[model samples]
Target: MTPYENVTFKERLHEEAAKLKEMSFRDKFWYIWEYYKFPIIGVVIAVFLVGSIGSAMYNNRFDTALSCAVLNSRYDSEALTVDQYFDEGFRAFIGLDENTKIDVDYSMSPSFDESAMNEYSYAELAKLTAMISSKGLDVMIGRPDVIDHYGEMDGFLNLEEALPADLYEQVKDYLYPVTNAETGQESFCGIRIGDTSFGEKTGLILEDPVLTIMSNSPHTDTAIQLIRYIFEQ
Candidate 1:
């Protein structure tokens, strides 16, 4: 007889469920939640776990995306932003201070004496290498030039023929030679990055000694993942 009777049974059931939900919010929310405590707890825990994992996955994705962006354009402002973000995210994983500085400097010789030249003019790439390695950057650099001297370096120099043998022997290595620890090894190949001018019009050329940091932060897992990404691309 009523309008409800005109509607189908399914519609009536849905309507009833909606009414129950509204009532539960007003009068029975606590009771209903407690009634299914186990299921509710399970859902709460599941949500938390999923959210944590999702955040980590998102950071990883962001790192990969930002790295690609950096490779194409180093000077892009976006690259700097993304790199900062990635560094912040990774910093969360690494136990380090908020103000930790990652100073990078390139030198013609890893053994360059700070006392001889402008100490501040150059960032100690060798020191950086030592820190990275000590921290177990987990990534190993194949070339001695790639890292700071882990031990003393001993080898032949072509310049010996041009200069006095005695002077050459004393000066071939820097006053503060970047030496190896276990095996005496010194850098062989290096690029002068400082004191250079790319443009003809530029009066003074100042190109700092160029240093190559082959990998990002020395996280082996991160490095492997990058290799995979590169191959796939």
Candidate 2:
């Protein structure tokens, strides 16, 4: 007599299916986990990594602070890195602490090709206006043309109103006055960021940098403090 006379492959398969059906929910879950745990964990990790990278990129682009924004007019072939100019004099001017440091945001003027008139494009202007209105921006550094463009819109803050009496007296010599279009009043618009020597210590100088400040900035006091430091240095 054969030992497997009563048993068949079909019978064994039926028995296994019956055992699976009888399993408790927890047991069934463990059975699946035993087979697929690695793939599940890998998918979860991938999702987390992607989420972290996306958040970092978004913040890097849009997360601006109350900062000194420099809009360069004439492109100089050779220029020192912005860091090169932030020496002891610049540091003291901005009230640098262990936790806080000066932030100078720099940008080139809109090229003629970018905006036929060498001005900000509509979209660019919109974004800039949003930043300015939000007080994310404080100071501006650019040239005459760049200054005139913003000046016409009455975008710049009035030093007379923004600065303390003593502070204004210290930096007024460098300020260029402009008339407000809406109010029809005159005020200092910006300071000339010239190639003029900031003396021997601050060796690196920007080629034709104009310094201006924004109106309605929450950090106007901080901006004035830096301006005072610059002039004093």
Candidate 3:
């Protein structure tokens, strides 16, 4: 047969080349490249910038969230816990220490005194002593205690459910404290960070006392700054 009838390689190649010019993926790509290069580049750059900024912002936000929580607690002068970082923020809302605290307990059906514990746990006595001395009170328990007390914040009450009805109203402003172990009575009353007083009578609770207790009270702006520092990245 003639070379033309047999379809020579060169002839087949030429035929394919012509068909590609008319209908090929490469040809279609050229049209797209010529028309949309600028718009495509712009979209890519915008997406990269947005993703980078978003990642940076997310990192910064976590740093701020942790810091604010810590600072708020320090402003109140309360001790913090490992788990506290993840908890609801209650640091600056009250006393320097978290109000969710409980005093040691020693119950005695027949009025038993805890003489042994006194030697080991004089911390409570020390606190009371310091509170009295700072207040310029008689420096004695129950002698120079809160007389005309009260809080000013509108939503500061902590009337926990376990309390007796009469005691509930009495200690609601105490800020969610646990009952004293020995007395079995609630003692979370007032913002007594050795100074920040609160109660139901004065309407202006913490003005006078904090000045004495703070000596530069942790209840001040300085304390809050420390909180910020400790909680930051």
- Candidate 2's TM-score reads 0.57
Error of 2 at 196 (Å): 5.1
Which portions of model 1 miss their true places by more than 4 Å?
1-74, 78-117, 121-123, 126-130, 139-219
What is the lDDT ranking, best to worst?
2, 1, 3
Q: Candidate 1 or 3, higher lDDT?
A: 1
The digit string of per-residue lDDT tens for model 3 on 1-233 reads: 76458898898779756755786798757765576667765665555455545644554443221111100011232332323422322234323344332111111111113554332133333333332333212111010122112111111122243234653454344332333344455533222222222211112222222111112121234223322222231
What local lDDT score does residue 207 receive in model 3, on the 0 to 100 scale?
A: 22
Candidate 2 residue runs with Cα over 4 Å from true position = 1-66, 73-81, 87-89, 92-94, 111-126, 195-208
Residue 121's lDDT in candidate 2? 43
> Better model by TM-score, 1 or 3?
1
The Cα local distance difference test for each model comes to 0.35, 0.61, 0.31
Top TM-score prediction, candidate number: 2
Off by more than 4 A, model 3: 1-22, 64-233
Q: TM-score ranking from best to worst?
A: 2, 1, 3
TM-score computed on alpha carbons, candidate 3: 0.19
lDDT of 3: 0.31
lDDT by residue for model 2 (15-93), tens: 6678679999898788756866777656655554455356435554753334766654333335534555553456555
